[model samples]
Structure formats: C-alpha cells, structure tokens
Target: MKKVLTACLLFVSSLTFAQQTVQRSAKLPNSDITETFSVLRSDKKIKQGEYTATAGNNTTLAQGTYLNGERAGIWSFYNISGKLIQTYNYTDNQLTFADSTDTKGLQYVMAGVKTDDDVTVPVKIGGSYSFRPTFLSKVLTQAINKDFGPVANATFIHTFSLNSKGEVTNHQVKVCINGQNKLYQVDDSELDHDLTRFAPAMVNNNPIPCKVITTNTVAMSNGNLPDYANSTYLGQ
Candidate 1:
C-alpha cells in the first residue's frame, strides 16, 4: 500500500512538472494597424525573462522582463521609429517608485486617444494598486479563513484617471475572490490614497492627463496561469 501511494504521488508530480510553458500573440485592441505582440509563459503564467514586441512594421516596440508574472527589473519602450522612448522599473508589478537620478526611467505610462480631423480627444493620466509577492505568497500558502483568506485564485481590477501632474483621481475599483464579487463601487478618495506612488505620464516634454487601469490576478491552482494572460500590457 505504501508503494502504491508513492507511485500515485509521483504520477501527480509528473503531471505538474509536465505543464509546458506557452507563448501567445495577439493584436492590440483599438489600434489602427495590425500591430501584433507576443508573450512567453511558464506553467501557463508569464515567465521571468526577456521579451520583445514588434509593431505592424516589424519594428521593435518594447523589450522587457517579467518576474513571476509581474514586470520587474527594467523595461525599455520604443516609438514607431524604434527609438527608445521610456525605461521604467517595476516592483511587484507596481510602478511605485522612480529614481530621479536615472533619467532613463519613465515617469508615467502614456494614455492617449487618437483624434480625427474634426473631433478632439481628451488627455487623461492614472495608475493602480498591486500586491507584493511576499504578501501574496503568504496568502496563497495560508489556510482560508473567513476574515483573512481567499485560499483560491482571485482577480482584482482597479481603474482611475490622472491629471497632468500624475495625481490619481476619479477612480473605481472592484475585487473578486474565486470568481465571486466581493467589493465594487469603492470611493475614489479611498482608492486615490493608495495611488499616490505612481509616476505621472508625459507627452512632448509636458505632463499630460492619462487613464490608468490595473488588473491583479492570483493563481492558486495548478495550470491556472493561462487565464490571467488576457492582458499582456499590465500596469500600463
């Protein structure tokens, strides 16, 4: 019986490790051209490594790394000309801090709308809150409790707008635990308090209004990582 149990355990372990890494490509939404991009994944979750994105012209649009499904280290972004436009740091997928000394670091992720010849578009700026891996790891490993646990996969979406100065305002947030809605219609002031750390977006050497959206997902079960890959542009 002991040998049989050991064999069963090995079979499960093999299945877990057999979970293959994946790569997916798609076109960005609302783009004028067929601008395509791709991302690498492991165990269905985005892996920690270097990635390059290309535009419709096959020009490099961005290059960066993902650490445990979050952008970590430094990411370099480029324009249509392939010129380096922005380089930024991410901690736990949060652009919480920037070093002034490093001029290469981006102050904000640009959010803009295209305008037609007759119509004008508005400029907005924003950012969101994310969980640190250390904190999240605890939550994942801990037993579920009524007061302080999800014990299963969950996702939270926070949206907001920013002024030219990079301050968060006019926001809405929703939290879902294991596919169940827990909180929605949170106050803007309450959400703004946590967004004070985000850097502002800039355009043509001037700060501009930007819209920010952040999605946080926690994968609690095996092979559950792929579902979180819907949006490759996190914290942007």
Candidate 2:
C-alpha cells in the first residue's frame, strides 16, 4: 500500500509539471494578440481591422485602421501636437490616399489667406438637419451678435468667392440704403462702422462666401426727433 501511494503521488506531481511546462511553452494565437502602438503621450490598440488611440488622460486621441503595422486610410487631426486625431481605413499598411488639398485642408488655408483669390460661390444644398444653411446662418448670426453688439438697420451685401475645395476667398462689401435700391461699393471702415459682423459661409463643412445682412434699431427713452440726434450731419 505504501509503495502504491508513493507512485500515485509521483505521477500526480509529474502530470502537474508537464501541464505547467506545456502552458508556458504555448504561443498565444495571433488572433488573440492585439496589435498596438504606443507613445509617451498616447497609446493605440489595433484589433483585426479596427484601431483606437487614446491619450494618457484617457482622451481619445485617434481612431482608425491598421494594415499590418502601418497607418492607413483617412485620418483627422486636431491641434498641432496631435492631441486629438482619427484614422480610417487600411491600405498597404498605411492610411488610404487622400488628396493633399482636400476641402477640409482648403478651408484651413482659406481661413489663413491674406490675399484674395477668385473662386466659385458655394450654393446651399439640402442635407441633414445639422447641415442646413439657414440653421447655420442663424446660429452664426446669434453668436456674432452675442460676441459683439446689435448692428444698425442697413443692407450690407458682401461678395466673396469659394475655391473648388469650398474655401472662401476675395471678400468685398456692397451696401445699400432703403432709399437707394442700387448697390454701392463701401470701404472696410464704412462696413465696419456699423456693428456688422460676418462668419464665413460653409460648404461641405468648409468655409465659403455667403451674403449676410445685419440690421439694428435704436430707440430713445425720451421722445426725440430722428434728425435732432444728427446735428453735425444736418447741413451736409
């Protein structure tokens, strides 16, 4: 009985050791191993064809696809340091090809343009609720007014061009009074004289030229004639 018990114990120990060794030597399947790339500030994990990157603080820095080990597809970046970015698609271990001067890039360029360039005007297109021009215009107007102040009652016409990428360029102003049906060229000072403000129109999520009109009405608490306020301009 003692010999049999000793043999049984030895067999159990050997089986345990063999199982442990097998487990240690086994290689995890590639499917079980997720591909990941990490930086000091951010870390990205890739699984199958999906990729997601997060900053140190748990902020989503980028999300896209990984082909093999290379970045592929469209990637969006926010801020210079790549604090926020997104990647899409996977092709040849790199992001898919995007036109260098796409609409989004052109919008950034147009926003920085010092000189004017003649381009096409962007027409309003129907889309989802968020893409409606009227909604955007109202939102922009309200934002401008909240930032600035109420503007005077006058018709100010601004002509601007948009490049093929839907970027605004070549901004000019034309003003018209109630009495004058014809449009008149106005200088920047005159245009700026009134509390007028402009937010560039957007086309396909890009800035473009769109006409904006601002009007303000001034009222006095005490009854006063309109002409009395303009004493200096009475003779002129």
Candidate 3:
C-alpha cells in the first residue's frame, strides 16, 4: 500500500509540472490587447484591429486597422499641424492615390520662380550657350595662334555661363602654351568677337552672346619650321 501511494503522488506531480509549462508558453489575448493602447510602446507588428495613434490633442498622427502587418483597410496620415497630408490605401505594398501634375511646377521652381506672391511668371531674361569640350579645345588652339606663335599642338579651356533664358552670357579662355605651361588668360570681349564672328551659339531659337577660351603650342621640326596640330574643345 505504501509503494502504490508513492507512485500515485509522483504521477500527479509530473502532470502538474507539464501543465504549468504549457501555460507559460501560451499567450492570452487580453495581454496583447492591453499593450496595444500605448503609442511608441509597442513596435511589434499589429494584426487585424482598430488602433489610434495621436500626436497631440487636435493632431492625430495615424489611425487604422492593420491586417497581418499589411494595411488591409484605409490608412490616413496627417501632418504635424493636423492637416490631412495624405490618405493612402495600401495592399501588398501598393498605394493608390491621385495623379500628380507637378512636372511643369517642378521645372518652374528649378528655373528660379519666386513664390512671394500668388501671381508669378517665368522671367524671360535672355538666351544661353554651353560649349562642347571639343569646341573649347578648338577655340583655345586658335587663340594660341594669335597670341603665341603658330601652335604645333595646343590644349585650351573655355568657360561660359547661361542666363535664365538658357543663353550664353559670358565666355573666358585659358590657353596652355608649348603643349605645357601656365595658362594664359584671355578676355571675354576677345572670345566674344571670335565666337560671334566664327562660332556663334544660339539659345531658345535665338542667337545669344557667348565667350571662348583656348591654349596654344608650337612643335618645332628638324628644319626649324613649326608644325600645326589639332586640339580639343570643352562644352558647358
């Protein structure tokens, strides 16, 4: 009788321990419900239920019911001022919203459009120009010939600017002599003369003003004669 009683007691104790282990692993629904009420407290993925996230008294940050971590239903987002910035319906990582017509608006903004007042117009200042690197090199070569002796070979740089109307307003030339040396600076007036006379640049279907820059060099042969070589140009 003593041995049987001891065996029964041992069986009951083992069953109780097993039940407690299962209960510890299982989570009660009410515990999750209690945690979901606080903001910034629960970062775990939410399931299908209604929840409100508020920024302040009047400003509601976001409010909606999420289904399996995906916004199955409607989701509304507000700015700090409580203004409705965007209302989105997200399903499987896809969003549906109104089409945007800000393409021209963006361009206008980039063109330096002022927004001080409601009424504004795109200022039509003047045209502009950008020189290709190849063109710049050619200009430099030419300038070197005029300033220095006949350049056998030369490397030049041209810098020009564009106005609001995309017109070339200024041009500057820097020339490297003897194929290597400190660059010689030339005035925009000189470059303007050459560009307007020989290589005029146009902007907005009109011929706008521009400047040119160049570097020159001369190659001496055994016979003491200079050999003219081609150079490169740069574009802005």
Q: Evaluated with lDDT, which candidate comes out highest?
A: 1
- C-alpha lDDT (0 to 100) for residue 87 of candidate 1: 56
Better of 2 and 3 by TM-score: 3
Model 1 lDDT at residue 100: 32
Give one digit per residue, the lDDT tens place, for model 2 in 116-164.
4443323211101101111113233333335334333333344434344
User: On a 0 to 1 TM-score scale, where does candidate 3 land against the true structure?
Assistant: 0.23
Candidate 1 residue-wise lDDT at 128: 13
Per-residue lDDT tens digits of candidate 1, residues 99-177? 2322321222344533322321122211111111111222222322343354445565655567766566555545566
For all predictions, the C-alpha RMSD in Å is: 18.5, 21.7, 26.9
User: For every model in order, what is the number of clashing pairs?
Assistant: 6, 11, 28
Q: Rank the candidates by lDDT, best first.
A: 1, 3, 2
The lDDT per prediction is 0.43, 0.31, 0.35
lDDT tens digits by residue: candidate 3, 152-233 = 4444454444443333455454555565544544233432221222222333434343333333232334322222222222
Off by over 4 Å in 1: 1-20, 32-47, 92-160, 163-198, 201-236
